[model samples]
Target chain A: MSYFSDIYKGIKTLLTGMSVTGKYFLTSRKGAITQQYPDNRATLKMFDRFRGEVIMPHNENNEHRCTGCQKCEIICPNGTIEIIWDRGIDEETGKKKKKIDQFVYHLSMCTMCALCIDVCPTDAIIWGQNFENSVYDRTKLTRVLNEPESKLMPGVED
Target chain B: MALREKNNKPNSLKTNNLELGTQNMKPETINSNFKSEEYQINMGPQHPATHGVLNLLLTIDGETIKKVEPDLGYIHRSIEKMCERDSYQQIVHLTDRMDYLSSNINNEAVCLAVENALELEIPERVKVIRTIIGELTRISSHCLWWGVMGMDVGALSTFFYGFRDREMLNDIFEETCGARLTMNYNVPGGLMLDIHPNFVKRVKKFVTHFKTKIPEYDRLLTENVIFQKRTKGVGVLSKEDAISFGVSGPVARASGYSCDVRKYHPYSALDKVTFNESLKTEGDTFARYQVRIQELWESLSIVEQLIDNIPEGEYRVKTNAVIKLPKGEFFQKVETARGEFCVYIISTGTKSPYRLKFRSPGFSNLSVLNHIAVGGKIGDLVAILATLDLVIPDIDR
Candidate 1:
């Protein structure tokens, strides 16, 4: 620990630290990995594995696969959900069945835990990668999935 | 005289060094206390080095600090109030937003608290997985601290290098839980999802890659003479003082206090694992640096040991499809990178908690400022504050 050695160590240490900055500043050649998010969503890829918002899918007859079973409602920990059933008459089958009437969810209240997707037995509801979920008003967050009612039970394989 | 300069100028808070200068006081200030002529200075309401809006009033004369007064409640978001408004499962997300840097731990803490309240039994496999992820969060948090602490002393390059490996940790986190900063991955009783297939392999790579880089970190920042000179004996809080002030984590360990929640009170699967707690006898700024630098290796070793041993089972416990907890008060204390965090929940036998309160580590860490920063040089103030690694939101909460 001589004085001269200490000076040299300080200079050497400084150079070593600067080199890290130099390395990063010079290495902008590294690939452009950032997706530029919302600006380029039309061109960018979205993985199915991406944990996005939850959505209920529909069958070929435009009938929602959500059976008013409340499986998703049960699995959701936040209770950012409310499900209502409506009695609907099937045109072909000519019988009344419980159908999903209102599927309400609050995005602001959502933690995106993804439990609702896992609990849905029919795979009727899936997590969608529409990540541009920012909204100005909390009221707009409460949503109902509007699927057509005409094609309900025209034909069924189940 | 420094007293003349203080009398001539009024306080405006536009200095790299935050100080509260000499002021008149009665001769006898305490009965048993030997510390003399302590002046107080507040560091924040808007100080960048305080890390997030902490207010500290420091007492000083010349270059040695005598008293540091920390005033908090700037960034508090009423997070617990919002939590009680949501259901048991909903509180998990709230935890993520509270401690943005250690979001995983936040998620895990809230979830663990909920499970404790509900008497929910988590699978053994879930506990082990929680332990591994929790340690990874610790590594990332420490890495960021090292870099910023260096920058606080005007060494900017360490900041970038710290983020270099930290970026890898974030990527690993991103792949597992989607969001980078606020990943609410842990839920009550278990994780939100099963561990991804490549998780073990990615972790194995990090263990080898990060171990090699430790020497590089030492060479880059820790070994420097200037750093050692700037930190040694500055802001030295003795073990007795640390315990009185309730300082935990590296701050308390640096002072020889047995305060790490991980070692004394193990949560998750930390009890099953063996890891050394890094300690220093000096209780100075320099000692805190050493404690953190030494702990990196220990944390990495824990990750290495647990990566292969993760049990095969459901990631989270299978609860009543929707979770509802019995009415009672539940309290949980888990180790954050900075110190011990206490999460308190009061339930009225409802879907949501009746009330929630988070006893964040930064509150206690920030509280000790007034005692340490008096009579110290302007240069050492940043160093002492950096050692505490204060996060603003936690303080406000």
Candidate 2:
């Protein structure tokens, strides 16, 4: 009698397990959780706060907000950001000011920790929403964030 | 020749003659001819059952495992050594790699240690938010463990169901922290940013969705006959042995050791929330599984209590650009999804710590494997390992 009872209990539990899977199987079409990533590229959107890569934004005048403070470079744990700057005369004030020659950003070495973004005093650098950062060449990952011939925005230093 | 001699004797005296002959026989002859030999096998540096790059050397006699020696350092990233060069703010990100499933909790532990050394008082809003996020991290980590536990016992469907629930939590994390896996949200003074505007709304939605799915989980794996049979009495650890081995989290709770760091220490807003420790006296594999499942419910309740009541205030307190701790030692411990995770820092009044040490939970839990797994079969060893829910990087770190 105990042997028969054990078999009955085993079957009953297995059928209960089967019912859970069976319900999912019948409704899987509407309840599917998987996303077709590449195919849905047009409709796909990342969160506004996603930390994909660091980028320097420029207005239509090709002017930026960077005042060459180098705070981000100094605070970066991995030396991912490098700024090359030289003294130049400010056209408006006729005073020599430190301006960036190139804001070198190594995307390859970036951990996406956003430490630099947090430490940036000028708000020159920001998180981009683009997450598709893969490339065939490693050197391509080392990017110059500022556009060519870009200069500091007017009154940004003030 | 010994068998032939026994056959010639009378049936009543045969047993006596055989015993006498064997007692007189040389020990080396018996060892060379009839003794069973123990063999060794490797479970993995790449084995999926290990859940990460953990190499286990197992000694077995026939089907029973004689020993399980965990060979670590395969994925050792030298995170403690790296902490020596990084600033207090920079160190929080590196802890994320240690236990990636509970990265937010790992980040919070380092931040709390730094804050304690600074003697800074955190805002009420920060405390409540950190507690809510930590509990969510616990639930997500347990979700992954549940899936892997079922898969380890040959139930494949649990993996998909577990990941489906975890994906929702990841989305909530990404929207708020900006990264899904390694969320460097906690800083020394407070959080990196305020919780996203939709954070409360989305979390409320997740709590409702997850409440219904937990019952489905019980049916899918918990009540399954095969899962129960594989886990019930596979590995048993007594309360005394659990304390002696220094095991914590669900592993120690299953043994009725009362070692929940959250209950005893009550860091962050845990003192405000009332929840059970989820204990079981059985200490077997099934008990461990049940404890983690019960914890999932407790975590959900914790989120519900704190979600609508998040006080509005400044998210972070301003700290020095170059943070140099006064010359002293500081220690802080937080209950990660695994167990008690401690951060010890010895600062010589510099921007970086002179020495840093992490007391991870997985390493201590892994030490008890050989003690419990000796007499169990190889399959039972896998089941025991699964219920332990070891994150290999957490151990190696």
Best by TM-score: 2
Candidate 2 residues lying further than 4 Å off, grouped into runs, are B1-35
Residue B96's lDDT in candidate 1: 72
lDDT of 1: 0.77
DockQ of candidate 1 is 0.32
Give the alpha carbon lDDT tens digit for every residue of A1-158 in model 2: 98888788889988998898899889998768798999999999999989999999999999999999998998887899999999999888898999999999999889999899998877899999898989999999999988999999987752
* Model 2 agreement with the true structure over B126-226: per-residue lDDT tens digits: 99999999999999999999999989989899999999999999999999999999999999999998999999999999999999999999988898777
TM-score of 2: 0.93
* Model 2: lDDT to the true structure: 0.92
